[model samples]
Target: MQIILAATPVVLLIVLLGFLKLPGEKSALITLGATILIAIFGFSLSFGDTALSIGYGVTKAVFPILVIILMAIYSYNVQVKSEKIEIIKQQFSAISKDKSVQVLLLTWGFGGLLEGMAGFGTAVAIPAAILISLGFKPMFSAVVSLIANSVPTAFGAVGIPVIVLAREVEMTDQITLISSHVVWQLAVLMFLVPFLIVTLAEKSVKSILKNILLSVLVGTVTLAVQYYAAVYIGAETPAILGSIASVVVIIVFGKLTANREVKDSYLNFSFNQIFQAWSVYGLILLLVLLTSPLFPFTAFMKANWDIFQTNFNFNVAGTLHTVGIYWLTDTGVLIFVSSLVGGLIQGLSLGSLFSLLGKTTIQLKKTVVTVCCLISLSTLMDFSGMITVLGLALATATGALYPLFAPAIGALGTFLTGSDTSSNILFGKLQATVADKIGADKGWLAAANTTGATGGKIISPQSIAVATTACGQQGNEGVILKKAVGFALLYILIAGIVVYLGS
Candidate 1:
């Protein structure tokens, strides 16, 4: 009964969003209300506790999550308004006429770069929008972006997910070991996702054979770079450097294989014109790198500015829940600033820039409400002990076979919370405990949690919301989810097998 009650909200959400094809905002709002009722009556949670939990969740949803989505869309809007996206599309076309190669470069290579640098949905939102602008179907753009966003998530936001997992499980001393385990667990998928996205884009098995060499090259380079970086350079730079390497390889590959006509198109643009067209993204990358973990400015800001950080504590159902916000370091602020400056550089006036931002906010209002409600639902479940009950039940049921199911647990957390880092926090310690009970390597299982969370990102409603909104398919989230769920399941199944064998 308790387990059923704990899972009711999730079940209801799936039915409404996945089956009934309801709008995300309506579905999430309905589920949130149901969750509140369950928490208050079924779980004996007080009204005060429920309210506090909702507050914390709303704050979190707005600051880094919704804010990031808002700004990412605004940045794209800035490009469209300034007519730079047209030039950007032409530049990509010049690189390769094959849609498969274009999809591979944009979704797999460039999307991974965004995930590594800033994450928080920039990977899915920015790249999906760009793909749509480049003439891909909206649904195709969203689904492929979601798929490509998966593997890079383990090291996203400069490796915050793994770093948080290490901290949560109190294995900071073994961070290197844990990072290596995560890369290995994700090894096969990292190499194969490029092929998956390309085939899906081309809509044919023949496309895989046709582009086999390029796919293999991309997969090999990305996997090798991530493995070495995770093992030697530490967790902070693997995704960042690996993604950069993927981009470089694709460009070089495209150049060497270019037809005379394609080469002519590439030559039609001056270096300055190309730079101006890509200036928005360039500024975003530069800003992200400057404030990334590799830089001293990030540390200096956190140390010198008290207002750069915000933390709120809520006593929910007798437990303390703290929501922390890092303002200055947030990807949203960086992207927002970069887009504003980039727009100005592209000849847009300040008035027009603010006008674009306003329009963007209006366009994404439904997404805002949906994200907030979903986050609040997750928080209520956590505060009411529903999530713990579910996790423990799965661990106990699987027992010795828990290794095969470890990634599923991580995926569940990400599905509920919509973040790889938050998923790790929710289940990292539980994974370690289960490892001890089942005689598995603690680090391996803990790392599996992060790896699994990456797969979950593919189907996370928060992720779907961002993708749909970016591609101007907001109300069709269910259509996209229905298409994406199969890939997400396959990803988790493969992850589970890898973890099981490795364990």
Candidate 2:
């Protein structure tokens, strides 16, 4: 009965958002109220501790996670206001005239690149918009963009998702272990997705059959580079490096298979112009790589940056909860500073850059509210032991078949929260707990949660809304959801099988 009541808030959240279609912010608030009530009365946690836990959760959400979102979106907005985005699109459209090949290059290759660079719906929104403008059907463009967005998401935003997961599990030393497990768990999807993209874009099997070798090449290069990076370089660099490497492979293959009779569309932008436009991302890549653990000065910088750090302790009953904020070493700062320098290099005036920053803040205000509330509620559940109870119940129910249901739980988290990072926050520890109970590999199980969250990207209401709104297909979200939910389930099923067999 206690566990059942513990699940009430989650149930209410799902029903409110999934069934009644309540706005996410409103649903979060309603569910948060329920969680606090349950924590105090049902779980017998002290009201003060529950409140402090909620506060801690909000701080974590704002600092680093929301901070990264603000910088990435601001940088993207800066590019848009400067018209560099148009040039970027013009360059991609120049790649090829064959719609199938273009789909592979733009949606799969370039979309993966964007996912690596920014990845807070930027991957889906930008690529879907470009595909629609390039003459693809609106719904098809949205589906392809969402599917491709899944490939690089675990390492999105310079690998913040895995970073956050590692922090939650309190196993920073095992970052390499967790990353390696996630890479292998996601390996099958990495190979399968390239072919799926081509098949989805082109309806006929004959068209897919013709492009089989090209699809295999894209998949092979992406997976190989991604695996190598995850093993050697750590999480921060893999997505960007892998995506760039795959793009090179695709180009080489395209040239080899080119029909001399057809002239490819020449890029309207000159080499210098292209360089200036993409310099923003190049700068961010450099800064992130320099500050990563692979560098010598990273430890020195982290120790010296204590001035920007925020640390606090709040007692939760007999226990103490500590929240540490490492501002200087945070990825948000790196991306924001890089954005400033990159904007200046691209010639945006200081005044215009600040203007773009202000606009970005305004644009994300609602998102800020939604994320804070949801994360706070999730933390409250965790502190009150509701999440653990639920995980125990799940493990008990599944028994020998627990592995098959693992990815389903992960998919459900993302479907509710619409963020792989948030899904990890809500469920990462739970996965670790269940793994211990079921005698499964703990690191791999924790990674299964994130890998499963990637599949939910397509059907996530937040993602679909971004894709449709960007493509001017607002009311067509239903149609787009119908198209994507199948692939989302397929991805989840495949992920479950991989985890089960590997275990």
Candidate 3:
């Protein structure tokens, strides 16, 4: 009875959002209400404690999470308004008349770069749009982009997902350990990504064999850089550096393999134009690095911004709630500054930048509500001990088989929430708890929650919606979902098996 009651919110979420096809925002609100009731009555949590959790959760969703979305979308809008997006598209198209090569570069290389910088669904949406503009069918473009985004996802948005998982598990000291485990677990996916993309795009495994060398080289480069960055550098560096390395290697390979007779004019863009278009992203990277723990001046920044910190703590029903806010040092601030600087470099006036920001905020109104409500629901369940109860049940039932279900739980979190970060936020602690109970490696299991979330990226309704809209096939979400679900399943299965063995 306790297990069933504990799982009621999650089950209802899956039913409403996954099966009934309800809007996420609506479902989130309904689930939030349900969670509050359960927390207050069923779990004996005081109303005050539940309300504090809600406030904490909503605050978190608003600051870095929702603010990141607003900034990323605004940055993209600035590029679009300035027409730099078109130039970037033309430059990619000129690389190869071979539609397959173009698709691989744009979707795998370029898309991976975006994922590293912004994450969420920007990686899929932007690349799918680029592929469509380059003449690929909307559905095909969406499918390939979705698949390509998976390989780089764990480290996406500068490793926020992994960092969040570490914090939630109360194992911040073991972040490097968790990151290493995640990188090793993802090694299989990295090597398979190139081959998988070719198979998905061409609808034939034979094509992967035909282009075996290119596929092998691309995969090798991706895996090598991803491993090095995640292990040696920092969590935020892996996807960015890995994707960049893959693109460079692929381009060099393409140049070498080309028939001697064909000259491609795609490299014709002036260096200045290219620099302007890419400078904003460079700025973001620089800022992230500067503010990152890796930088020498990080201490100075943190000390100077102490005044901006906000802390709240309360006790209700024997539960302790402590939340902290660091406004000045938030990643969102860096992203927003980078967006503005990029817009200026692209020749947008100050007024225009503010106008675009306003529009983006309005557009994301529903997203704001959705994120807040969902986060609140997750927090309430957590504080109410519902999440712990569920995790305990799973740990006991699975026993030695717990590793096999690790990725499944991760995939379920993402499939319901449609965001890897959200999935980690919801289930990372739960995974940690289960691992502790089962005597499994806590870091490995926590990291698995994130690595596994990547598999659900293609099938997420939010991702499908973004892909369809970007490809100018807004109402064709069902078609894209049906086409992508098979790939999603295979990816998750492979992820689960790999994690099971690793554990």
Candidate 4:
């Protein structure tokens, strides 16, 4: 009965969003209300605690999460208004006329780079928008970007997810080991995603067979580079370096295999024009790298500049949660600044840029509400101990087979919270504890949580919201979710098999 009660909100969300085909905003709002009621009555959480959790969730959602989504969409809108995205689309077409090749380049390569650098929602929003502009179907573009965004997430935002997992499990000394475990667990899925992207784009088995070599080459490159980086370099640089390598491989492969007409089309653009069109993203990358943990500037600022940071503390059901916001160094701020400067470079006036930002905000109003509600629901579950109960129940029920379900717990956390880092924080310690009880390898099980989170990302409502907003398919999140859920389940199943066998 307790397990059933704890699971009600999740079930309600799927029914309303997937089966009822309701708009995300409506479904999230309804499910959030149900979660609040359950927390108060079923879980015996006090009203004050429930209210505090909701407030904290709303604050966290607005700051870094919603801020990232807004800036990503606004940046794309600024480019569209300036006609830079048009040239950008032409640049991609010039690289490869084959839609399958283009899909791999944009979604798997460039999308992974974005996820590695800035994460939050930029990976899905930016790449999905670019794919739509390049003439892919809107739903296809959203789903493929979501799929591509998965594996890179373990190292996203300079490996914050894995870093947080280490901290949560109190095994910071073994981070390199944990990082290696994560990449190894993700090895098979990393290779599988490229083939899936190509097949989805071409909608034919023949297309995948024709581009089989490219897919195989890309998968092997990403996996090998990422594994070496994780093992030798630590967590911060694997996704960054791996994605850079993938992009290079794809460009070189396109060049070597190009027909004369395609080669000429690629050469039509001037270096300056291409630079101007891509400046927004380039600036974002530059700014993110400058402030990333790979550099000392971020550490210096955090140590010396207290004024640039905002921290809020909330006590929910006897547990204290701290939410921090870095005003000067936040990726969303950098993205917004980059977009403004890039827009000016493309010849848009200051007033025009501001106008576009305002319009973009209005366009994403529904998305903002949906994300807030979903975050609030996650917060309520956490503070009420509902999520812990579900995790413990699953561990107890599985017993000797617990390793098979470890990844699913991680996936469930991400599905509820819409974040890999948050999922790690929620379940990393629990996985370690369960592993010890079952006499399994604790580090491997903890890493499995992170690997499984990549799968959960596909069906996350917050991710779906970002995708829909990016592709101009805002009210059709249910349709997109229905289409992508199958792939998400398949991904989790594979992760489960790998983890079970390894254990």
Candidate 5:
């Protein structure tokens, strides 16, 4: 009875967000409030402890995400005000003449770029909008974009899933991260699979999936370099490194392909055009690099912040957890600086710049709130032990098939919440602990969990929302999810089989 009621919020969230097309923020708040009431009266946790637990739950999530979200918002603002992002997108003009390459590049390569730089479904949303603009049907654009977004998720935001999983599984340092680094880097290589499909659809796939071969060949090099980075240099930079590597690969491949075919269209973008358009992209890369371990960029950037932080520890009904939370200006500061820099470079006024920020905020309010609420509720469930209890029950039900379900569990968490990092937090440690108790290969199990979770990226309600918004199907995400459910499930099953075979 306790478990069922305790699990109500999650189940409700899934159904409401996933099925009913309810707004995520409202559902999360309603469900969270209900869970709190149950925890207080039915489960009999004290009011203060319940409140503290909720606070702690939200705290764990907010710290890491705040900067990420703020960076995304600011970066977006910079893109719009400076017109530099427009210049970058202009590179796709020649390709847009062919729907196939349009889908392939924007949906796959561009998707990976967004996933690497600013994950959390924006990859899907932003790209879907571009695809829609390029003349694809809205639903198809949403579906393809959703599918394309998966490959880079394992390494999204600099391999955050593995990092979260590593910390949860108690890996203090290098030993914990190498394999995960390899996993995500490998996932980056897998990105080519979707690209090949997009190519096939484009009819430019040469009847033999030629682009796939090229992608795979290039992916191999990217993965090889990324693995080296993870094991020897640093796991933290895998996404950034791999993305840069793949971009170079694509540019080379483009040159080779164009040289062989000698298409006049490819020759259109002049040196000046390339320079003007890629400036913002270069700046984006610069900002991200500054935040790398190889540099003191993030630290230097963070130094300008005025942060309000609080730490608290507690024993809640004999269960213990500690909390650290921050309201920092780091991400906001980066965005502010970037916006100013980008605007100045593009010749925008101070008033116009503020207007861009305002418009971006107004547009993003619902998205940010939905994301924040989901994090708060998810964290609360985790901190309260409710998620563990429910997961244990589900794990018992799966029995020997737990391996298949492991990633599914991660995927399921992501499906509801729409963030892979959040999913890792929800299930990464729980899966590892179970694998150990059951004597499964820890590496294989970890891989399965990660792989399965990546598959769920497509069907996720939040992802659907991003896709719909990007595709301009704003209020009809549920329908988009329905169109996508078939592929999402197919991919999920395929990933499961792959994990099972490897295990």
Candidate 6:
């Protein structure tokens, strides 16, 4: 009865958010409130402990997502307000404007680039907007962008997941073997992304053939660069290098392909025109690139001041670790710089930027509140031992079926918690613990956790909010989540099989 009651909120949330057509922000809060009240009474969690747990969970879940949300919406508002985004779109138009090419260039190339550079929802948000503007169906555009965003995510933001998973989770008996194997499997998965895109477009063979050549070319370049970086130098540079390499490849090839007919009109790009892409992004590049540890500049920055990271930690499964990293120097700094540059480049006055900031703050109030409440709710669940008990229970129930169900649990954790990093924190230790108890390959279980968590990033309500809002489908997050469920489940199952066999 206790277990059944403890499980009620999560099950209700899944049903409400997934099938009942309940609004996202509303459903999360309602579920959270009910769970907390239940915890206080039915679970016999002392009010103080329950409150503390809620505080901790919110801090853990909200911190990472807060960074993503502010930066993302701010980035979007800046680009849209300043017109730099418009300029970027215009440049794409000077070339081929085929909706499909638009998908390939923006959703596949630019989306991967963002995932490589920024990760989180920014990858989908920015690319989704571009695809919507380019005339793809809105729902289709959001789904395609979400799917494409995954290919580069394994290494995004300098391979955050790979590094953290290696350092924090015991994914294998031979740590090196497990780490490298996980990367390899993800790389193998990358090969199918282009095929997935074509399949999403209804599998037209003739159309597939046209894209097949380009797809292989694009995939090879990205996969080779990513794999080599992961195997050599380090994981910290794969996302940056892979994405930058692919962007250059696609833009060059795309321009050349369209140049024949467009040569006399808008095809010619001067140095000034080339620099145009950097307007909204120039300072962002400086902040993330220079501040990245894999770069020498980050070293220089670290020497000057505390490298601007805010660390937050809490007890998890009776253990503690540094699970939260706020790169105040990286993307946060970029947001400030973007506001300034976006204003200047777009010709907005300083006063206007401030005014816009004020308006944006007000505009995003509900979003901010919603995120804060969700984080607190998730944090409460974690600190109260709710998330751990739930996961361990599932692990025990699945038993020998763990391989098939392992990834789903990880995915489900993040689907509720809203960020993969948090999912890792909440469940990583438990995954390893379970693996040891069962005599299963602990490392394989850990890898399954991270890979599975990645799959959920595309389907999480938090993710849906980010993508839908970015795709201009705000308040319709339920529709988007429903639309992507098929692909997401298939991906999760495939990842499960891969982990099982590899293990």
Among the numbered candidates, top TM-score falls to 4
Could you tell which candidate, 1 or 3, scores higher by lDDT?
Answer: 1
lDDT string for model 2 (1-503, tens) is: 88888779867865666566666566667888888889999999887788798888787667655776667666667677777777776665555545667777777777777677666666776567667756788888888888998868888867878888888777778887888888898888877888888777676867766577777787778788888888787777677888898788776666555565333555566777888888776776677666655566657865776787778776766777776766655667877887788788788999989888888777766556666777687777777888767766876888888888787777766765567887788788888887888788888888888898888776776676566555656545556766777888999999999989988
lDDT, candidate 4, equals 0.91
Candidate 4: worst-modelled 10 consecutive residues by lDDT: 203-212
Q: How many pairs of residues collide in each model?
A: 0, 0, 0, 0, 0, 7
| TM-score of each model, paired residue for residue | 0.97, 0.81, 0.83, 0.98, 0.80, 0.87
lDDT of 3: 0.75
Q: Rank the candidates by TM-score, best first.
A: 4, 1, 6, 3, 2, 5
Q: Candidate 3, residues 337-368: lDDT per residue as tens digits?
A: 88899889989899998998898778777667
**lDDT (10s digit) by residue, model 6, range 255-274:** 66664556456645566655
TM-score (C-alpha, index-matched) for candidate 2: 0.81
TM-score of 5: 0.80
Model 6 ranges with Cα > 4 A deviation: 57-64, 170-178, 198-205, 252-266, 296-330, 437-440
lDDT of 5 by residue, 311-336 (tens): 56766567777654333323334445
Q: List the residue pairs that clash in candidate 2.
A: none
What are the runs in model 5 whose C-alpha is more than 4 Å off? 23-30, 49-86, 117-122, 132-141, 173-215, 218-223, 254-262, 267-273, 297-332, 464-472
Model 5: how far is 285 from its true place, Å? 2.0
Per-residue lDDT tens digits for candidate 4, residues 1-503, read 77998999999999998999999999999999999999999999889998999999999899899999999999999888989899889878888887888888988899899899899999999999988888789989999999998999989999999999999988899999999999989889877888888887777666656677888889899999999999898999889999999999988887777789898766477888988899899999999999999989989999999999999999876778888888778999999999999988889999999989999999989999999999999999988888899889988998898888899999999999999999998899999999888799999999999989999998999999999999989889999999999999999999999999988
Please provide, for model 1 over 218-325, each residue's C-alpha lDDT reduced to its tens digit, 9 standing for 90 to 100.
888888998899888888888988888988988888778778888876737778677777888999999998899888988898789877798888776667777676
- Output the worst ten-in-a-row residue range by lDDT, candidate 1: 203-212
Which pairs clash (backbone N, Cα, C closer than 3 Å) in model 1?
none
TM-score pick, better of 1 and 2: 1
Error of 3 at 122 (Å): 5.0
Cα lDDT, all candidates: 0.90, 0.75, 0.75, 0.91, 0.62, 0.68
